[model samples]
Target: MAGPNIKHAAYHGPSIMKEIFFGISLSLMAGYLWKRHHWNIQRRTREFYGLLDRGEISVVVEDD
Candidate 1:
């Protein structure tokens, strides 16, 4: 025969699992978006600098 407290504990387990699962899901999504944005900006910067190095583009730095 099971006690009343044991039944409540059993029901709470799945609710905890659901919360953990959603938390991980949100974290992974945020990480992926951050990585993607960083990669794109780095790529563009490199390409622009590469073009400048080749004398195909001119850069003017203003004196402060």
Candidate 2:
């Protein structure tokens, strides 16, 4: 009886340029997200502080 030989598939990893491009793109995306998050946090904090300073913290109950 003769056994069949199987050839494994070869994998070509990402090129150096591809890796660099992906790294830069991912870094930019992360930075943008981080900056946006910080901006939103700061805006909310400022709003809260402004309301507090003006003594506008009140709860009004409304029936729908």
Candidate 3:
């Protein structure tokens, strides 16, 4: 019984590695998307106002 149990013991190394890789990939993707969206909004706002630089750190969007 001891020998059989040892033989069937679970190894979680591969699953843990896979989860770490997946988490990193997802975090990087989310960060990239967030940055891209922010840049796009800044670009559009600059074009609309003919601004030369992104001087302000934040912009208020009012409902119309």
Candidate 4:
């Protein structure tokens, strides 16, 4: 039931190296993006607080 001259399909080959490379690259990119976003949010929050402290903005509450 086994053939001695069977060839592997074009879509079926060794791709371990490629997979690992892409996986690492994509993860690194995602991590970079996440960190950048976190830093931006932190900076915005700090700026908002600073503005509030300097009286640049105010919080008003309305009772209904």
lDDT of 1 by residue, 1-64 (tens): 9657653334434587889999999999999999999999999999999999998888887589
Off by over 4 Å in 4: 1-12, 61-64
Per-residue CA lDDT of model 3 for 23-58, tens digit only, reads 999999999999999999999977866643554443
Q: Ranking by TM-score, best first?
A: 4, 1, 2, 3
Q: Candidate 2 lDDT, tens digit per residue, 12-42? A: 8879999999999999999999999999999
Error of 3 at 23 (Å): 0.1
lDDT of 4 at 37: 100
Provide the global lDDT of candidate 3 against the true structure: 0.79
Give the distance in Å from residue 46's predicted Cα in candidate 3 to where it truly belongs: 0.8
**Candidate 2 stretches greater than 4 Å from native:** 1-13, 58-64
Residue pairs with backbone atoms closer than 3 Å in model 3 (clashes): none
Considering only N, C-alpha and C atoms within 3 Å, which residue pairs clash in candidate 2?
A: none
TM-score of each: 0.68, 0.65, 0.55, 0.69
List candidate 3 segments past 4 Å from native: 1-14, 51-64
CA lDDT scores, all candidates in order:
0.89, 0.90, 0.79, 0.93
lDDT of 2: 0.90
Backbone clashes per model, in order? 0, 0, 0, 0
**Judged by lDDT against the true structure, how good is candidate 1?**
0.89
Residue pairs whose backbone atoms clash in candidate 1: none
